[model samples]
Target: MSRREKDQLHLARINFLNLIGQSNPSDAWKLFCLVTPNITEEQVDDQAETSSKLTLTTIPPDVVEMIVRTIDIESEKNVRLTAKYLKQIVDARDTMINRVHIHLCSQTVGIEVHEVTKEEPETYSFNVSVIPGVNHIDNAVKKFEEIISKPNTKINHLKIDWVRSEENRASYDELLKSLAVSLADFVEKVHVEELTIDVNAVEHLENLICSLKPDILKRLYVIGPPTCGNDKFDFSNIVILPQWKHLSAFTSSCCELICPIHHLYHISNLRIKMASTSPIDIVGYRDTLIVSQQRIDHEITISHDMENTKQMLEPYIDCSRLTTCRGYYIRSNEKRLTFELKHNKIIFSTMQFLM
Candidate 1:
């Protein structure tokens, strides 16, 4: 035999012996006779029948169920592949999935599902290759449904990443559209808690966010590619969605938001991008926080000139109170709102009190 084969056989023999020692002692001698190479043909024939009875399928159902319950999702999937009875046992149980991430590439769609247990978190990856050969979109959707559509599966977070390249641009867009449609169909069933998407197309992002069940989704994040001057994205439709209106936390990174700033005032935690923040916008933000009873924290990253923005807000700077080099405060009654301008970021915080 080859060196690798011999090493593997040696390891297997040691493992079988150790397992036999820990378990029932009566089967040890029988298994020992089966493993020993020097045993005669007649001896092998005698133990063949006994060894057949030791197959994994012969394990008691309750014991098999207990074993499958303790393993991670991937291990449970492997156990199901080993035998039909094991598959049945695993399918009967429900598993808690912590996160599901879908990555859309030019030639392939990748899926990552995570399961958290007492020991550690377990991750499972599934990739559907669309490299110009097979049924592209249909095959990908089929594989996606197979993995995420498991009965009684609960997912806490869902993230879709669109990483399209210039080479296969057309195919990538089609795949993304198909997947987004498929995702919209099952938004209610998954009960996704937090959704973070990196989409290049504004329409797709709006559609995806609007499709989410409003009552179930609480956190939303939109991460777009970096943009230059005068290139702003329209999120007018997104702000109107019930899902967006009810979001407890919202984050928009790298892309300049063109809509009115008032649409974001209700979110408890907000991180958004604006091409420019006018003096009127700043005053409105401060006024909203002052009379509000709810807690609020906001971080606005500006793409315009920092000096110009500071000069514009100079008139409204509450100079009567103590002011630092780059820090400005806007206070009303007992509530004090602070605005800190550092490089391209504008941070705003409010001290809220009960009436």
Candidate 2:
């Protein structure tokens, strides 16, 4: 074959291989040799480089993401790390890399792990140790404060897992108090879109939520049971800031869900799972009330019977000021009701009232 003809064949093979590699790397490797007949290893490498450059230039960014996502993270981490074009594809999309997970093993050993599946073998893990003879609570609080102060990092989600620690239970309360203070302070400055806290320490959870200013927290999820103390737990003291839009609670105690809805009027989305079957009262603006209630294994029943439960909701519904509801039934034979109101009319009425 002529030199020009051979070059054209090589380019074709290169483009074909690249397409397959992006779509299915394992399959691409299996068929690599058949398409590039008599091509040496060095020639194949050069062709791949040429094809990568061409792909980067010609393909739309979103299309490149589809190709990058096809590769398994654990198996192809090295390949992704080495290829500039592939790395760009992974970074452009908000895949797994943007999140950080912190697991508290014990007072002595704590593990912070960050995994991004889009990047090849680019896993980052940091281990934080408590100062010897010093308080682990202090160390955790310090680290948390540092994370909150950094403005450039987009840490919208935080997960705290407290691994069972027999040795650390003695000082758990002090540690929890410190952690709660830090969390409460953090929420004030940072836009915490989602928070997941798993600790045996219930006091910390209460303190953290109570201390939080609530203007910056858009969503909250507390995982654990409520604490029993000398004083009765007053759900009213727990303030639900106007900024809170989504609230979720997983507690062994059924009563914890009642306070947030009864006092906090701004939540638009709410999910709560409790140990027992108890009647729930939901109150909110007609435009922003979306509630779902379910039992452990039994059916979930959602009521649009806002008027039946609370008289205040009647005026909001009658005037057409508040109007949107969506409920989902999970597991049990339950009824769900949803409503949507016209906001334009509500706005006009409010303006007229002001005049």
Candidate 3:
């Protein structure tokens, strides 16, 4: 026997004696015999006679069930393929799945799991991509249906991303609707995270959000270029259900924000695009809303309010751009600065109270 094999045999024998001592005495003695090379032919014959009938059911109930759940699902699958010990690990209970990624780029729908317990939480930018590939649509969808429909699983995070092109948008929307329908059927009430989707139609997006378990969604981001010949989805029909206890961020392409100030301001962050020359109605109302837009508000100045004024700038940053109390145009290529908003304008300054 190889050194590794001998070591494993020794370890198994110890585990057999420790946990399976009294109840599984038969297994205990057989393991002891494997570790002891000097065992008699009588014992070998007895083991041979009984080994064929020994089933995994003979193991203790708890020992038979080993819950191995994680964000690194691929690694678990690979290990299970090689080790019987791992194959015996069940996917059902005692598992805490912090993030669930449904990778759509590959031909096969990839279900990746990373093992994280309740005490530690992990984060990821939820994205869904459907690049042209050798993907079999019907088979892939079926596989995804099977994975998401797995019983006895509590998914805390879920997202699928889809890229948009004028030619593929309508088709893409249909696929997204189908996927959302499937998810709603399986996914129950749970906390949601960053979901990057292409929302070509408002009704589809609204229906998908409504399907999710209410009140626990933390963040849902709608990203991608505008669809329908640069026309934006009218956000008039969008309604915030009472169940969305934690729904905050909702940013979509060219989508307008209108009534329901309570829910509107509840959105602490949003990214908007400048579609027209007319000024957007975002300047007056202030409710701790952080707005990010493609157009830099020339009227707004960024103020630096750090305790130490000079600490705001990096060592390599040009000091010429720094001002005592004036708003400067921010170019992302130059340097990133800490900023706050005052009077509906972005403010950045050093050695002065900004707001």
Candidate 4:
């Protein structure tokens, strides 16, 4: 083995010694033999020297877990190949690792689904291009199916950026149906706290929303050009679950006009970007109720050409119970505007009361 590999093995043995609560020579030798291969007297002497040369420190498992969790899987794979002992450490702690991200360059499934634990929390994002030779849709579907069969696996968040070439664009509906069926099952298994989907294939936003299992969805963000010709996008067809509390949309002016904000009574954060001018009533029934409960927080971003700050601020001012309002606003160029409202009270002293 190389010098680096030898050093790693020595570190692993020291770590293993610390884990089993035996740091003395007698216990270390016994535990080392139990876990590692038998070694000669001369080899043991060399390993002891190597271990002594390095600073031996004991770290709590929770701290180690946090450190390991921060290392991306792809980077960990490189470290594992350095030595067998390191591989063991990674395998032992794989389940506690929470975040996993993969950037796809090839059309094939880059990762083996079986290698990862099902219950381990993971977030996945795919950046893929569908060229004549690259068939990402097929590969993606296969991976999706494999993940669904595992009972406890939950992908808390998923983002897909799909690009289709001019020559080899496939049927959008067929692809959507296949993906929907595969993901809808998994979506039902876990509470989908966040989801971001960007696709040029689907013409209507409602069609995309309809394809998902609606009951478990809490946050939905959609990004694409407007499909509906008018300012009002129709969301009447969608069944908004009571648990759904956040909605963000990036679309053309006409699409924002049709966005269904009235339907989302539970939503606390609503962000929308529109291309054209549209009248918005900020003090709607939902806002009034949320304000009463002290749960009001919202942001609305409109195109630069359509500026209506006074009109937009009218509803909030009218609904506010307090005479003074305190808030901050920052413009696109980093310019800031701040305001504060104050209240005054008067007190009478004993002498004043007597007079």
Candidate 5:
């Protein structure tokens, strides 16, 4: 190494330490990179002379933590590559990723990462697309796990959308199954507060939802494929899982729930669409909520046309004298259940009362 280059490198290291503490994290890192351009681990460890290069190991761990915490993910990655000690420190620190969105459409997979801030949030988008006949689902998931699996990382919101179309419906269907299996294996490593997913298959949905950390997941939204006629999406396996039972609120895409209404009573708030509404099921669910002490609100929309309102309500109450778009309240004990019939929708909510 030349004497002049060594002196310049040493001066840059001294300036980096001085500026890092005085300037904001983003500015400090930018300046540090400008001064130490393309400095490899080998250069960092060079023992050419006594006063030449400065190794990051000489810096105290507390100072390293402070520097890392202020920088962005990209800077953190660069810092980790500098030395083994830096990598360990960076790996152990908790990084708060405010939100993540994963989208799978045909053959392309998109990943968006959002960082939390008081004002507008910062977003990073990554789209990974493979060739026509290769399996890209596995590769996409691996990239996703690399971010979420970081030690002590907490994600506030996570959303996954599987956009399936008719162009390659069969191929997408097979890919969806593969994606589900991969997600089921690694989803346990993620800690997210709220999740919104678009899944069409019951088995795939079950595997993904049931694998989440129940204690961390509070709200879950499921968007299933459109249904017609008597066909319904079966949630038989999901209602039994702890993740479903512990949710504070749940929203489902407009489709018939194959499971009975009572299976959803435990959730505090609910918005669901039923393929076909039966007076028996509506009355039974109403009766169950009225007698229970738990407080909840539910809005159920009947997707199919309801031509006869009288026939629908006859199982629970007399609706022969009632007109369309009427709001009715049924009170039993301390609970009051409001039932509104508007077109094909039934909006009913239970009131919370102090015991």
Candidate 6:
């Protein structure tokens, strides 16, 4: 601020405090308006409509933001309620908040707050008890909506954990619906992380998960038996099928799926608790053309050591269709890389792929 602004602000504070200490809120607000006389919102909109050319710097946006950031969170709402000028600051788009966690419970909604320190990852939690008529999720979302309406506000990570309660199934589902909708426009949606939940939301998770764009979803984990004796919840309906187009990874305790041959390009990993009990033929392309020096017919598999395995896979990658080292017949494709661990060697051949 310039010398004139600094002096005016100092004098305004002194006079404002005197009136406020005398228990005159109205006079204090009036004195505030006298000092920071602002043009009406209608006038701002009118100018924008009247002018086709307007650079971002036309308004000192940075300075306005710096002035608004001086208000503390606890007092921000009060300041908004007190004066029209302060309300504009609160309404400004760009949430200064960086992190938020919502914990959904049967009878309470808890918000987890992590401190600025990163060493121990210390966290503190505040909870709002569920009210009978009011929806917990809707109420919780109010804070988010108020801040996120700003064009620049970002929600870093939204971690929602649901503990199933039969008595609160309806409410739990409601919570999921609200969260899914509110986060529809969320940025940074592609972050991958393990998520474990068994709740009312599980019953229709497929639709909710599919509603988001392909890249918005991350790795997923589906645990069985979210509710008491409800172990029969169909994991296949939710995760095993190719529902969300390109979810990076999916793990389910109670479901197993024939890895989608055509959709392998979209999925990174599909693991089932029962997969070990069955043959693991992941990313197999029966008719896929093997691409090497030439377009040759071969199969592919995943391997940790593609270098050492290269000796075994050269014929396959080269479309030789025969293992030069072991003299074993091999089949392959350019679209699929198949890895097989046998006799301490990486093998790509199977009975079906052998010519």
Which is the better candidate, 1 or 6, if ranked by TM-score? 1
- TM-score for candidate 3, residues paired by index: 0.44
For model 5 the local lDDT of residue 273 reads 76
How many residue pairs in model 1 have overlapping backbones?
A: 0
| RMSD of every prediction | 14.0, 13.8, 14.9, 14.4, 12.4, 16.0
TM-score of each: 0.59, 0.43, 0.44, 0.44, 0.59, 0.41
Residue-level lDDT tens digits of model 6 in 1-355: 5666544444333322332333356764564454434434353334334422112222134623443355344433323223344335334534333344556666666665432222233233324445576655677766545444555443334455566566767766776677567656566332323344444435555544643345545556665442323334434455444445556565555343323334433445554333222233322332232322222222223223434544533444343333333323233432344444332233433333333
lDDT-superior candidate, 1 or 2 = 1
lDDT of 2 by residue, 1-355 (tens): 5686656656655654665555556666666564345778787677666525334333444655464454444452323222344444434543222344555555342435342333333322334345466555566567656655553233456666555456645455555667666766554444444667654544455576554434545556665534433333333344433433344322222223334334333333344432212234434433233233321111122333433533433433232233432122222233333332222111111111211
How well is each residue in 11-114 modelled by candidate 3, as lDDT tens digits? 43234333334546686566444434444647444444433212332333453323212113333232222223432333333333556654444223344544
Worst 10 residues of 2 by lDDT: 343-352
Task: Give, for candidate 6, the lowest lDDT window spanning 10 residues.
Answer: 51-60
Q: lDDT per prediction? A: 0.60, 0.44, 0.43, 0.41, 0.60, 0.43
Model 5 lDDT tens row, 265-340 = 7777888776554323666665666666666677777753455543454444323234543333455664455555
Candidate 1 lDDT over 302-343, as tens digits, reads 654556656655654443323432444545455455566667
lDDT of 4 by residue, 1-355 (tens): 6778757755565544444433467865664565445345565555555433112232335544443343344432423423464444444442221222222333322332222233444433333555676555556666566654454333445454334443323433345556666555554543344556554433334454554444545566665544545433434444343333333322222134344545543455445543334333433632333333333234344443212333433332221224434333333434332322223211111121111
TM-score order, best first, reads 5, 1, 3, 4, 2, 6
Q: How many clashes (backbone atoms < 3 Å, residues ≥3 apart in a chain or on different chains) does model 3 have?
A: 21
Q: Backbone clashes in each candidate structure, one number apiece? A: 0, 7, 21, 6, 1, 17
